[model samples]
Target: MAAPPGCFVGWQPLLLLAVLVVLQGQQLRADFGLPTAVMGGNLVVRDANGINGVLNAMDRAFRRFNPTGQTDRLMQASAVISQIALNVTELGRSVAGSVIKAASDRSTPVDELFAKLQEKYGRMSRYLDSEVQNAIETLNKSIGSAQSLSLKNALNSVAAAVRQITNSTADVGSVIARIHETTSGNTIFKAVDKASIPADLTTSLSRALSNTKDQLTGLSRTIEGMLKNIGTTNAFLARFDQTRQATEKNIVGNQQGVKAFIDGEKDTTVKRYTNTRNAIIADISNAVGKLNVFGTNQTLLALYDKHSEEYTKIYYYLFNRNESDIQNISSAFDAIGHNMEKIVVDSTRSVNSEICYNKYSGQVINTFPGYQNGVVNCMTREKNRLGRITDVMDRMLQLILSTSQDLANNVASCTVWNGFDKSETVYRQAEACLHTNINEMAKFGSIIGRELDLVQTLGDVEVAASRYRLYDCVAARNNEALATIYVLNKDIDGCVSEPGLQRDVLGGGEKGGDEDTEDPYEAGASTTEEPVYDEYLMEVFSNSSSFGDDVDKIM
Candidate 1:
């Protein structure tokens, strides 16, 4: 017959065994001439023990039947809890060897069934705990990195590329105008070096192309090195992700196993514990019932049962809080851990604004420790790496600007030469202007070389050197163009000076002598002794737009 669901189907045979044990013990006490009332509790306990011994004998017999060569750990737990209640039920319901006979044809029952459930539980707690510790350590490290990182602020923000480049625009204005005049005046072919200008332009263009090619080669190498570092960072991120995913999978599967183990093991063990408790209650009731028998009254032994064939049987399960509460009582709890990752989120951004360019939510949690340590660790490391790159790149950008400004000053000296008229003596004026421009260009190069040599960020010095070669080639081309003009200007030195040029010198000029020729700040230190902002150095030249600002000690 099919047994009822959600009930112990083997309880029937176990109850019968318990009754037989009680009767046999009663008979033994009668033979010993002991009164039933005086021997009541002791007899029931003795009978229960004897019945448990029989059940252990069952364990030894069934051990050979189950192919698994190990004891059922859950059943073992049940067996230890007032063993009779636990063992009798398992033995009766077991579809293995018949209870009456086991060696008839040496065939066990089920006639056959899955037989791999006999192994006991192992120390899963130890493995899970070790993993948790590692995960937490990683989280702590990540948190620490985030907390300790430094970032830029208004105070620490030195002038970057934008500020540095624009500040020198005034200084180069004249140079830009000169380049325009030289190129445009070449239309007449009337300059002293008119015959040689074409060759000068060709040499300048050729050098520009060659310099560009060299810059491109250096740039390619720099890009390749950066790409390799990026690849390594990506690999590290992938490894971090893989470790997190594997840990999550293991933790999820272990949760399921733990749930199943508790539910299955509890089903049998709780029943055994409950039954033993009920039996003890019933035994006491029966002892009271013995006294009631003399008084001719109803007894509690008739109450602990739901199916008692006594004169009066009131079901305790119906009246007391027993099996009826099964639906209401929680036998299992599903774990739903809440990760409040807000702490990491809130603090990560607050540590340093420059470092917190993006939001980092370290929110992966297989368990509390996994989320707290491992996920936080991984995310923090990834974010911190990005912050570090931004810092390096920002510094690189600043260095590039400083370097570019230096090159611009060198190139601008020739490029921005203008405001001089195209007169017969224009060539002489061109040489004076060229002399001043070239002197400042050489000074810029000297300062730039010193500054660039001090910088070692990501091979920036090498990058700057390559870039300088390209700009220097441009400056060389300009020098050639200016030299052609200088030749023509010098040739006109023998030709009586034009009145138009003479008027420019007398009307739009400062009639200074040796002071104009000497660079007061040739040694590169300011008279005020205040540290010069390297970007601001270009502003101090006599030819610059800000020349009138402070022309005494440093101009």
Candidate 2:
């Protein structure tokens, strides 16, 4: 008559109910204790008086009726069932009255047992529901605390970066304002005042100005030292011009015949003329070399080293006082661009050579516009300088050959006529034009040498000014980047503000219109333009072609 371990002989309902209650209690224990298994969210309530406990007490009462299977024993089972029914009412009130009424209607052991287990399952579900609620509350609190700490740390990082950027901006503004103050009537200075400048900016400005002044003074000293060399070169060329004219008249005027004069002048007048020509060439070469801009351009230097013995050879340059010589020298002058390439390289290095924005690659990209613009200004100034030099050189070449036309026509008959009278006429015209050409060349070369020195000095100034402007430009860029970061930390869509970042960096530069901006070298057009020679020297030669066939062969 006894029930099985998990089932009963005729007590199926009670046995099934007890087993299900135990199984459900274990599941509730797992659910309620899940927080402890992971991060320990501190859920306090456990399965102490849950439905499993109530069922255990009911099982004991059922066993008491096991020995006496009589009608009176049904009262004992009912009493035990009523106790469970009360527990269900308190825990799950909705099913309390229904469970009790269903048990009373059947009054049989199996029917009452089924109603009891149903009520116990409901009680256990309610207990788990309460515990699960507590666990969720604890989990929410933990998540909130963690999120707050993360947000705070993020804000702190952005705050620190913002503070650094703000200080840098102040230092940069102060430096620019100080520059403006000293540059009274200067383009940028006119727009800013001391009242608008921050106190910290003044200190940085003072240091920058002091350093700039020192650099400028050093340049001034360098120029002052070069002035003596320039004077020496000018004096040498002046004396060489007078000596060349005297030598030409004495030697070429006394030739006897065409063949004897050519043979005789080769060792005397031609040798002296070759020496004077080479000397002027050396002077111009040395003047350009002293600049140290381009170390040594061999191709340009080769034009000056023609031998006196090979004076009439077409292969040589200065020996041919013909159109070919003009072309050769022009090619050499064109090669001056190779020398000026150094100015471009040096100016680019000066503006953006150092790695200032190491933190971000994008910031490095931001510096390129400034570097490019600076180089453009430098090359423009240098290009104009080259134009002026060539302009004066062009005028010199035109002046030197201005009187060659009449001589060419007069000598046209000499080539046909063959005598001392014909030879002397050709020789005199050739000698006169050659002497005048050499004198004028020496004078013009001296002027170009002086102009080259001025151009080099102005090029140095352009590089320095570009470097200063680039410093300001990059500082503005870095500051703007930091400010954008600060805004991004606080806002989700911070990228919207980044489009104008580079624009803001170049804002200060836009203030300097083409005129003010183009002249960062501080040398205006009128300042760098080549000056005219004295009227008497400029008008010394007639606008006639005098480089006749005899003049070409004599050279």
Candidate 3:
């Protein structure tokens, strides 16, 4: 007697048996190492035939469904469908993973197969007789549902449009009513005697009344037509109320979201930047103070004094009785003054006499070869040097005196009086005062920047809220219209499936049956015939496995 067709004999059975044994071991481990040898034996006896039968049935079904002549086409189609399903599943999984990652630091992998099932087959497929056929049916149903939703949405949209028209009409009516009330209340019309009224005025008033009456009549007709088309005004109002409620809810939610986002940004990013800016300002203030101290250092003051003395001597030599020396010195003095003017202007300071003297003294010492040569020209080098020095000294002294006079004038003319102090002390106090003012300005700038940022954030929030409110109304109306469209599509689909349309398309009875009997797959049979799968699957599977391993290690 021959063994049953599905009975496994060699390494195949052994491999299956090994897998079963491993599963049994896992089960035993799960059960706290309970003695499961007898249970394993029972599993083998109970499941072996059923497993073999299922495998055989799968093979037979594949052979029947996928014939040799059409294997490639069917396989390619299946692969494409599977690929699409996988891609959709992966997209859903990624979305879910992103949501989860945002909520928690953990990465969770959703089952691709489950996601595919949900996306392709839907919940109704599980109860259907054939999963594939039910999948098709579910697709049809979903299309129907979508169509119904679209029809409903369209109706709602029309209703909304009608409501808008009605509102416009009401507004026009209110305007007309106001005009009528105003005209009726006017005492001029009542006081004017019919016989005594000017003919031109009476004619003008009658013409205006006629025009107004004509406009009101046209408006009334238009309102009546709109009301008839969109059902009663009361019905439109009821639908508008529903739409308004939905819109309000959506607007509130969006407003809250915008508020939360603004609050979070202000607390985190804005505040951090503000603090950093404040700290920078404080550091800058300290740096400015250090610069002021350096500017007034003893070494700097000594350098300035030497330069001043040289400048004073040069000035005295230029203005003395020697004619030849006077011309040369005057030209040098002018050049030095020009250069000093340039420096003071470049530094954004006024051309005060003290600044002029100091700057000219430095420039003369640096630029004049004659001053150095004269130092060596005299019989006694001391005399020539003394002469050069005295010339600079006289110029500097004149500049200093001029500067002093200006300062004294300014001080004496001032309304606010403080105790008298030395010039050096006053200069230091002025430097400190300038530094304080600069610090205050920087602080004010930082405060203003922060205030502007706050105002901008508030404006952004308000804009977002306003946009949300407007779009919410549009969305609510659109959703309702979508629902109406869905109903209309259902009606159309039902009409198509009815006996009349079905007979036209599918040949329900005997007429034109030959056309319907022809095979749909006949034309393409010769061109396509080979086992095929999507090339991308192998790569995807490898990548997925690697990713899974990495995740497992991390967990």
Candidate 2 clashing pairs, residues 3+ apart or interchain: 174-201, 402-544, 403-544, 403-546, 404-544, 404-545, 404-546, 405-544, 405-545, 405-546
Supply candidate 3's per-residue lDDT for 188: 35
User: Model 1 compared with the native: what TM-score?
Assistant: 0.22
Overall lDDT per candidate, in order of appearance: 0.28, 0.31, 0.29
lDDT of 3: 0.29
lDDT of 3 by residue, 372-480 (tens): 1221121122212223322333344344334334322332222111211335655565445444433343343344334434433443343333333322333233233
RMSD after CA superposition, every candidate: 59.4, 38.8, 44.0
What lDDT, from 0 to 1, does candidate 1 have?
0.28
Quote model 2's TM-score: 0.19
lDDT of 2 at 346: 27
Model 3 alpha-carbon miss at residue 295, Å: 6.3
- Which segments of candidate 2 are over 4 A away from where they belong? 1-339, 347-368, 410-555
Between candidates 2 and 3, the one scoring higher on lDDT is 2
